[model samples]
Target: MDVEALNALMRSEFSQVANDFIVQSVAPMEAVVRMPVAEEHLRPGGTISGPTMFALADVSMYLVVLAMIGPVTLAVTTNCSIDFMRKPTAGVDLIASARIHKLGRSLAVGDVLIHSEGMDAPVARASLTYAIPPRST
Candidate 1:
């Protein structure tokens, strides 16, 4: 779908707080989400935390699926597995590149690779499955 429609749907379905969690660089098949490193997102080693990365992965997958299927607010995550690979740089933005691996009638699967801004390797990787709502006649 178009950017305007996608932005409209995001504003309607998700709260402004959630919307502020990540910016939508693109919709559906691919998206780039940014998460700013902040005190609340830091861990013991002064590195960005895991939960913050997980949130990025989750929202990235949601946007990819929604891009393919339109704004399905009922679409819910059925499964998710994330692997944290490296410590993220402090005071940097994290970018998640998410794409759909499969899109079926009842489910959608997505893979995400997250990296710290300017980092060469991924800091984390995630695979997610979402249950898509049935289409109305």
Candidate 2:
């Protein structure tokens, strides 16, 4: 799926979380997702929360795989390892760049680097695996 198709699916099928993200771009084995830092996503320290970052990382990879395999809503994350590095820039949108290293019939694996908007170094990095449901065939 491309950006528009994925965004439309998000709005139609997953409206609950659709407004929080933007399917910015997709290319071969790669995708970029954007999440604007909102008041609700912040902690008491004015920093983006861990769960919020994890969500971005997870969803970013999910979109990347979807870009390759079409809209597979049943695909689920089976494993994720994330490390929070630097503090994210407050009030800045976060950008997650995901790259698919391996894609298989039943699984897809990738790594994601999340950076605060305009920053060079990533604030967090994640490696994830998704369990793609069997095709009807």
The lDDT leader among the candidates is 2
lDDT string, candidate 1, 33-120, tens digits: 7776777888888899888899889987887787778778788999999999998998898999988888999998889999999999
TM-score, candidate 2, is: 0.98
TM-score of each prediction: 0.88, 0.98
Off by over 4 Å in 2: none
List where candidate 1 sits over 4 angstroms from the true fold. Answer: none
The lDDT values for all models are 0.82, 0.95
Model 1 deviation from native, Cα RMSD in Å: 1.9
lDDT of 1 at 111: 92
Worst lDDT 10-window in candidate 2 = 37-46
Candidate 2 lDDT over residue span 1-137, tens digit each: 99999899889988999988899999999999999889989998889999999999999999999999998999999999999999998899999999999999999999999999999999999999999999997
